[model samples]
Target: MEKSHLESALPIANERNKASSRHVRQKLAWALIPLTLTYLTFSKHSPHMSAFHRPAINYTAQCIQPSALFPKDTPELSKAFDFISTPTFVNASIERLSGAVKIKTETFDDLGEIGVDQRWDVFYAFHEYLEKTFPLVHEKLKVEKVNTHGLLYTWQGSDATLKPTTLMAHQDTVPVPAETIPAWDYPPWSGFYDGKYIWGRGSSDCKNQLIATLETVSLLLSANFSPRRTILLAYGFDEETFGYHGAGNLSALIHSRYGDDGLAVIVDEGASFEEAWGTVFAKPGAAEKGSTNVEITIRSPGGHSSIPRDHTSIGILSELIYLIESTQYPTRLYDENPYFTQLQCGAAYSPEFDPKLKTLLDRRLHSGSDETSTCMAKHDPLALEAAKKGPEIKYLLQTSQAVDIISGGAKVNALPERAQAIVNHRINVGETAQVVFDHLTRVAAHVATKHNLTLHAFDGIEEPSSLILTHNEVLDPAPVTPSSPHPQTPFSILAGTNRAIYGSEIITTPGIMTGNTDTRFFWDLTKHIFRFAPGYDDSEGKEGMGNIHTVNERVSVVNHVNAVKWFMLFLRNLDEADL
Candidate 1:
């Protein structure tokens, strides 16, 4: 009886297993319909999605066609061509530059490092050299000294009704480190001229501009080129360390004299016209990146290293720095960024740009948030390739930072009670000092919270160690300059001069200054502050060789001559231009 019941149960179990398998197959068949629809939906939207969604680039005044960036080109005044002389005065100019470089008129970054007794005598002698070198300029232009080192010369215009223009340069050169003297091909202060070039500290970094301005002005005055508008030659003594002392004092004096927005334009030593691969890119640093030096110091209990805690002051500081350096500020595009505007102008002119690179740049720049991740993924591989190929171009696209200096661990036995890191930021054109501060605050807070650390101020307040402190107080973002094309605009006038000199071979456009200049103090004086120091950016788009602020600093004598010519032409054309 038991065997018969078992046989019946086995048959029933087999029937139930077959029913379960059929039901699962029916469910899978129904699921395929939605899966196919979902895949189709994703494929349709793939072109619009971003792996990390953000706003697309804004085409700014700087990015649009040349017509939009500036007004129509004005007729070139013939007077500028009168003095268009070849670099014939090369030897004499080189000699003059060498003399200027020979003077050890060095400016220190820390004001305290410069002593009252060490007050520069070379600067006074340099003043005497200028007086002796250019008799006509000395006799014609009224010269005023600001704080001893700063030099201001006003070539009074026949017409005072017009707003005056300023030609700017710095009088001082960066100090050569005592240890690096052996590395120089010659004494850094020798101002050694080997016929082809002048080797010294300031040959490229500025004294060249000072000498060139004088050379141009002297030639102009001698030729009876009386200016319709007054032209001032403003030279600062301290620009390398941020232009506060030299340019600050001079700016105050000028502001008091001229009032706000009084000048037609201010021309200073800045970014150069770079010739690379048959394309000449004019980098007139019309806009300078905002700068702020941030300092983050971590503090904790001091104890023997042998009896260390889970974390120490140095460890905490290191972790914070890692967070900042490893994770960079988000890359964003702004229409106002002059750097991208420059690229837009460059791309318009150059056939050399790779088709794919151009396409990616244009797509990314002109694209909107609605663009799909699939679209980005397809182009991103090439976009990233383009950036890697031209790192200089990449630098223009984003706000940059570097952890320049760090200090901690005074002794091997004692755990560090304090550690500090100095991070320098060169702000993108549209961003502000506040944005940088906010970034620092956010990063600091995260690190503090994670480690149970606390921040303390010098005054006495103590809390989490997330407090942000500036190495040198805080620097307000520098004012933005627009070099829109107009007969009266500096860039417009500059373009005429560039055409006169370089012809079609040279392309001039407004670009951003990666480093800050003395122009910071003179922003209120003019909206058109054009920074074009006559030099060449090399093949890789670096500003000349690594000679700037390094050993064996030098520039060609021919460049020095060309600089003088450019200055003369710009001044002559500017004189005749109607503001």
Candidate 2:
């Protein structure tokens, strides 16, 4: 592949790792704060506990008590678990995943017009690989090809009354830089299994997930386990490039068939469990941040560099960028925010949680909105600490803006007629694209007035020396999935299934995905969407998860095996679940 091929791919691993690392650091910092205060007094009978801490106000009792559940231990379930646990089965699974990782189904941001782009031809080979490997799946399930490459598999159920369960994963991997190929312990696409990890690019990212879901279905087929509820498996081919051609098309078909909130529940690859504050914590994404791209173009009449005006288009663009960056969004902690619930869970369950921080959190949990708002506005110790942590910390509570792309003059001797920048914002919960539009409009209006330039915002008015603002790929924050303590709800069942596999001591809490997923396109299919992949998080003691989206990316055999087992159990539980 040309160097340009790698360059045009959407940025993934580095950005994801940076944001993930910062979030982890912020969590640790929250637990490390040193200050002691008396716990805020609250009536034991207080019924005003946030919905997140439903069924009780005392955090300790509710979150610590595990709600682990399992499907009735049938002979089929026992055989499936026993078979997956065996060394022979594990080695086979390793090979299964290794085979998938070896395939290069890389997707790029600029792989323009799918059918016209020969680059997309790789997915055809990937399709053959899937069909060839999972014969049982191919033979038993009804498969439909959406948008040529997207895969939708349906296993018909005996009953039509129950809603279908949808499982998702992406088929594409980000391009491996040609320059970084030599740094790998094993070749990036080798899928080399070193007794522990299957080393490759897609091993850790999504091939592990894709393979696990398919393998589980195949295993269940072998066990002759028929479900009362239908199961739908959808795999998008271009999730790395915003999934427009892949999941975007698949979701439209799903919506048309199922209608609004039609599916029983949708589970996709997302946040994994990590060790923190002396316990294993699984943070299945209950919500995800929205996203948008704002284009700011400053158009002017070009002139000789020697005869530059008071401000060229490039100069004005720079000033606008500065103003946009300087105007930061305030981080407001709401009682209903998923991260807030995560903190509450940590305080209640994490054995090593800092008592001082716990006390503060406890106080905030019971305090009135007026008091909390005042503290946040004043940048009190709590708010100050959060800000000091990093942008990822603030991002958990507020929208994030970054000036990612910028371009200007093509020649040194000539003033540029057009200068442009694209500002990317991951919209926070409780905010919309309009809020971003309004903020940018304010800044652009001020700059246009100061420079005495014509302004054209959102509507194109081709004119010289004018400032224009337009947006694309706008998405509002996903509706928050209910994480009620009621055991039968989708969140609880998923959480319970997590505990059943990982152990009762494991803490499962509702958390938000700071990054978006294919679930963004499937929001209409079901409100009960969960972005969780049952794998061990790459924390201090856990090294199973390799670097995702970069060289040496790999997934541990143990992680892959557990994912397969978990999927089998989760599906069985869903089949039997009344909800």
Candidate 3:
């Protein structure tokens, strides 16, 4: 009996040993899988690594790499950060800027066609203050008044072989709407400072950049630091009013002086990013969407209310609006669509991002930075859902249309003789204004034919613009800012400087700006235009959302100080650079 029991125990113990060995092997395999993939990842990035030798390597895929995207930082970087963040330096800088904001330099876009020159005395006073405040800048730089209010300061650098750079800031600011006046924590026009905050209009939108620029240049002059490459301080009087006279005239002046392709790079105000998802990203605006306003009209003979036709002019206008809302611009995402690449980059690099989304994006990286395909399964559902929930996402993906104004009926119970609307369109990449116009006209014609009414795209306020067919941009999308692509492009100069000043805390990506800026004037002047306003506001819910063009509009004091430091450093860095 003892011998039989021992044989049975031996078989049981043998089975247990086999099971433990299998479990160990399984765990080891799972651990080795990640190690193998990581090795393959590094191997593919290596110059000498071959796909044949390492079959698992991602040989053709471009990744959302962190270190390689930006230039290596110099040892002086430590001292640079120290100089900007000091309390004494920052405090003094903010106090002076707060005083500058106290001057109300509001610009009003009037009557749809003409700019209302309200508060001329205030503008003149602001101009005088700039001269008084920045005496060093006024005395050293060759300052000229373009259109009286616009300040054109030229700091002629030592070398002409190096292409010049233009740093732009607008003198004018959008008027505070009457409806939002009550929302102001401080008076909209009162540029008040109560210890920490600088209160008022123009404090954030652009005045922060404008004032900071003057300070930067003035201090540089005080230090006797002259640039090696020519620097232009282009300030626009009517940037808030579309910059026709302000930036437009400045562009003409620049062209006459330096010929076509005059500027090496132009940095204007538009957008910024400090953090996104679980990661941080620093970006100056790369490209912006195009814009156009189409004035649509339907006309009919006046008829009595009692004896009205099947549909009135006003009814038809509403119908048209419905049609536009229903039939949105086609949702097309191509390889060249600028926003997609940035979207992909965000999903792939951000640690907090959904893993499934990252996997999808990584699959497309095989096309080497170009989005290989617009994954139908992922995008179709998201796009449809976003259309109902978030218009902002739709706006980024495709051309967007907004039916702004509709006016028709005059007296109560009277049949309307005419009805009109202004449909504003933000033209998308891979589409044109003409194409959009044609689409609208075609739809209008079809609708009119069905209703038996006369439809026309008028050129009047209530009419269509005078230069619709003749001019390419009839309130068309703003010119997309040009990019001098990476490694050693004109944009790399700004990128390098940004990385140096801001550091590698954020993964920077190029993206399309939603709105227009003064940089529109410099389209032909330079192939490289970056809409970058360097100010970080931890208080403002998000970057670029800082109450700009809104009541209670204000920027952080530290940001203003940083702007001054950034420009001073950027100019120095650019001077030292080969470009």
Candidate 4:
């Protein structure tokens, strides 16, 4: 393929060199304070908590705790729970499983006959099942088919004036390589429930969310619980492969319907229960870091091995790599980046942490880590070790980036004239791809005086998005200040959802997401967008988490029941509010 316009527009080498040198000097000067703080923080270590007072607590009780934070219980909640828990609903779910099996069987049958793409066949089969089983929903909802890969369903709200809420889930599953785990206790696609868990491929990555939303809406419809705001369900089929068919088409469709007035909230599959300090935080996701794929290329005159040039392409590329390794991005402990603060706070609350350190952990940001001992005493021990190494290490602790690909040499006897490397970056909050690219460009140019190197960004900027709700909007401007005490300004944090798509209208929070999902697409759409799933933590530790997107992917009988109840509560609370 020809070089893109971006690749061809590499700036003059001298300019980058000068800029890089200035940046390096500035970074070196500013490094002293953090370096001192790091030293002090690492010097001391506190004793561990007693075994009897271990911080870890049961997950279910934590979730069911009576808290003023959530919506007040409605009479409908118990009814909803009862219906979901009943044998009739369980049987209905079982029948739905059988239906899914038949659909998959038909899909395989058709694949054998027509030789269609397996992914397309699976999507078609799921689509057919939805239409047949939820005929009433199809009739009432505004449904549209996206070409080849996805479907959209919109339920117009009772109040025509209200904005819409979108629920997203992907229909696709990552292909389980045939050679990898050959035998399952039950067939992978059979959707068999063994009294405790359901076994299937797409079970947790999405089908669980899909079933929960559908069943929730179905029960609400049966009870005539009409929403005041429009609701949209977007089901995509190719999320595993860049979400081209699913979220891409759905995003276009949404843009066409709402324009810049934008969506109210986009709910997607991510952010749920996780063991934190031995307790379940049930962290909800609010925003995600942006991603950029960059390419760095080096070129020079070719030569025979017997007469190599003073600076060959590979040698030049090596120097560029060294510059990147040495240079580091800044780590600002800004309050807007709340994930770290929350983690620190949660750790402080844990019984596992020493009581003497609790006060430091609670106000660690304000104290500003006067010394390495104090900083280490307040934060995670692992994080402290990483911070001392420099900005590159610290940056990865918060965001994502990888030098994933590289290529150079051609023949053994001849020196290659060109070489290249690709760096994939996940932009942290309050950072832009352009900034990262500029930093790289300057660094590469500075090192290229002895070689010939060119740097270019392969992908455009994907800026992070956030939502921050306010009550009177007259409070102090401190970034770490808690949200207003208004129902509209719920005390929630953002994590793994695409709420950034809507821009400034919505107030956002920074949520830490440990895994990647299809929710990234919504960052361009709405402000109040959040990634939340209602399921109690299973007691099996890491194995429980592994079940998701794995062989025994399942939502427990109890969790499936609670999911319906929780969804109803969320909908009711959302509907009653102006937000």
Highest TM-score model number? 2
**Model 1, stretches more than 4 Å misplaced?**
1-88, 113-115, 276-278, 364-386, 455-471, 535-546
Instruction: List ranges where model 3 is wrong by over 4 Å.
Output: 1-84, 111-121, 363-389, 455-486, 537-544
Q: RMSD of candidate 1 to the true fold?
A: 10.4
lDDT of 2 at 136: 94
Over 1-579, each residue of candidate 4 has an lDDT whose tens digit, in order, gives: 256655665555667888999999989879887986765554332223122223443322221212322334446755765677688987787566445533432112122222355536656667778888877787777888876657888888988777777778777666654554466666667777877666667666667777778777777776667789888888876676666556877888788878763777666776565454444455455545556666666656677979987767777767667767666555443334445544454543444543443333433433445332344333444444434555543653444446787798899979877676776666665455666666776775566533433333333322111111111111111112232223343333121111221122222223444344566555556655556666553554454453664555555655555555566556655666575
lDDT of 2 by residue, 25-81 (tens): 988877765421211123312323332453335776546444777887778768988
Using all chains and alpha carbons, the TM-scores for the candidates as numbered come to 0.81, 0.86, 0.79, 0.68
| Candidate 3 C-alpha lDDT tens digits along 435-527 | 677778767767777787544444333332111111224544444544434355655555555656667555556666767788877887886
Total clashes, candidate 1? 13
Q: How many backbone overlaps does candidate 4 show?
A: 25
Q: How well does candidate 2 match the true structure in TM-score terms?
A: 0.86
Clashing residue pairs for model 2: none
Model 4 residue 52 CA deviation in Å: 32
Candidate 3 worst ten-residue window by lDDT: 463-472
lDDT, candidate 4, at 504: 21
